[model samples]
Target: MHTEHDWISTPITADILRGALDLEHTAHGVLPHRLPAWARAQSTDGQLAMAEAQPSGVRLAFRTRATAVELDALPTKRVYVGAPPRPEGLYDLLVDGRPAGQASVSGGNTLTIDMTTGSAEHRPGPAGTLRFTELPDGAKDIEIWLPHNETTELVALRTDAPIEPVPDRGRKVWLHHGSSISHGSDAASPTTTWPALAASLGGVELINLGLAGSALLDPFTARTLRDTPADLISVKMGINVVNADLMRLRAFGPAVHGFLDTIREGHPTAPLLVVSPVLCPIHEDTPGPSAPDFSALGEGRLGFVAMGEPEETASGKLTLGVIRDELARIVKQRVAEDPNLYYLDGRDLYGEDDSAELPLPDQIHPDAATHRRMGERFAELAFTADGAFAGRGA
Candidate 1:
């Protein structure tokens, strides 16, 4: 109900954005990219392209006195073919580092994806305005977190008063890369994602390179890690590899070594932690190119099923268990020479006991509560005294 003339429009510049590697100028507006343009040009997969454009950790951060703020964005929401419609993605508003409010745009573009055939169709829709009103009266730091799952193009930012980009708070920057789990799947909102929550608890700035269905050990991705600046770095490996059936044990070992080598090239002494996949019961022993289970589609539930046989591991197929052992051994071997390199068994974050209480809703991704649990556990293990990221700074 706001009149356009009454609000002041602020240019959505790079200075106000955080956690995105690239900003793509689009026909409609600006789109944030987790991967750089050069890295994206190297891949032709629609999945990776879509994932990178989703802006898992991106946010608009500024200091403003405005009590009313509105953001006009065109979000590209995903619709799984034959599955129940998904809810509108939520935009979280944080005031002075605390959650203030949450809202969602009513309508936007839709990308209908057919998992069975790996096909996607896009249907354009009008942009929607998300308004947050009656914020704190005085000047305060504000952050608007973009939807972690949807591809959102920022059209405009309107505030009742002027806003300036928030200055750096001298917090350590943690760069993390992984698969869809790290990409904020099934999390209630962007700030509630495990990494986001962990970053908040640990008092660090986050640069999340967690690409969904696309965390294969690509050279470009490794190079992306190598090029980005960070005080602490972590790579949660194995889940995607096991679920995609992407490589064998023999290939995985070397590929991981190469990835670490690339990262070390840029951050030789930064605390680097290598995390194995969290315990996924279905893929703990079973190998897979996991597939969507539509059996519960009629009931409005979408689940995943393992497609590979358990016995395939004998032929060198990768499984979560095997990958964990391999990652532990690799980190153990490398730590002898590199004192800063560390390893964490992802099971330590979420294990059998935790799973019994908070099972993964889709049989792959953790639900919102599980994300909170994992985030707390991670902060306890990695950010506490004597932890891997202890004593780190910006």
Candidate 2:
């Protein structure tokens, strides 16, 4: 009944299975597909199906190899946490909930999980590749969990199986540019990034160009977007520009136009949406100031001043509102000639009403729950049949 090809089909190695498995969870944060109500009714042992036919909230793929592995993969699902949970970190490789290895996340975004040690912790370093080795000959599946305190991006995995290539089904590409918030700052996972979530909801591919603190309308970033391929595009501006106070009104206006001009060089007719900043009560119209804080180290305390927040912004100067108004005026002039171009008020993405319900913990980035809400709203407004910039070629 079973053919040899099936058994020897690259052994169904991990790399081959990358981006295929997803963890579907409920609003209550429980994996429902893994714990289907019907399955629970049928058996007392309720082991949910971690790998199923439907898309998962958590997905993984492979990246590269380390310490002699047959293959490597990336995680389709990426979980993002603002801070590490413990010094030991929180990435663990569990075989049926039994610890097979340990992982530690460090430097805020890097993870070092020991597949053999059964203990992991968070450390300080840059984000890097995750490696796995010494697999049992017949191991069928593996699961990675982001512990309660830490957040992680499932960057890559390794296996020996041949990967089934994803067919390019002519899905329209959605290119997005923004700041740390767009980079997933406080979101729960990579898939939960508003752009990623919205892309999934709207059945589009995503090219997330969100860079933390680097969205100051740099010429390089503009060129990068201009050269990248895409069927549709959007630039979420304002907040970063305002926060950084990178330019004055005259410079800002020309920069916005230039950014579009650069992108137009590559995507002349693509539907381009320019989004303003979302609601930030304290900083909406207020300027920033140099604020110092005391760091309570183990032995003693240390004083430090934040790098940004110039002295001129101490009294309601250089605010997001100013940037938004300027961006809106500049985009309006450009849209006259480019009917395909569009503008989306950031308020439509996240408004004062929503902010009341989901306050920004840092007065900047939205938390995981808020990210979900923003993604849902964005899809509803921007992807609807009669939406302002809908039906453009993907």
- Considering every candidate listed, which one attains the maximal lDDT? 1
Misplaced by over 4 Å in model 2 are 1-157, 289-317, 392-394
What tens-digit string does per-residue lDDT give for candidate 1 at 316-392? 99889999999999999999999999999999999999889988888899999999998998888999888899767
- Weakest lDDT window of 10 consecutive positions for candidate 2: 45-54
lDDT of 2 at 228: 68
In order of appearance, the predictions have TM-scores of 0.97, 0.62
User: How far off is model 2, as Cα RMSD?
Assistant: 14.5
Cα lDDT tens digits for candidate 2, 290-347: 1222232222322222344444444434667777877788878888889888888888
lDDT of 2 at 59: 28
Q: Could you tell me which 10 consecutive residues in candidate 1 have the lowest summed lDDT?
A: 292-301
Whole-model Cα lDDT per candidate? Answer: 0.91, 0.55
Q: What is the number of backbone collisions in each predicted candidate, taken in the order shown?
A: 0, 43
Q: Candidate 1 — what's its lDDT?
A: 0.91
Clashes of 1: 0
Candidate 2 TM-score, C-alpha based: 0.62
Candidate 1 wrong stretches, greater than 4 Å: 1-5
Clashes of 2: 43
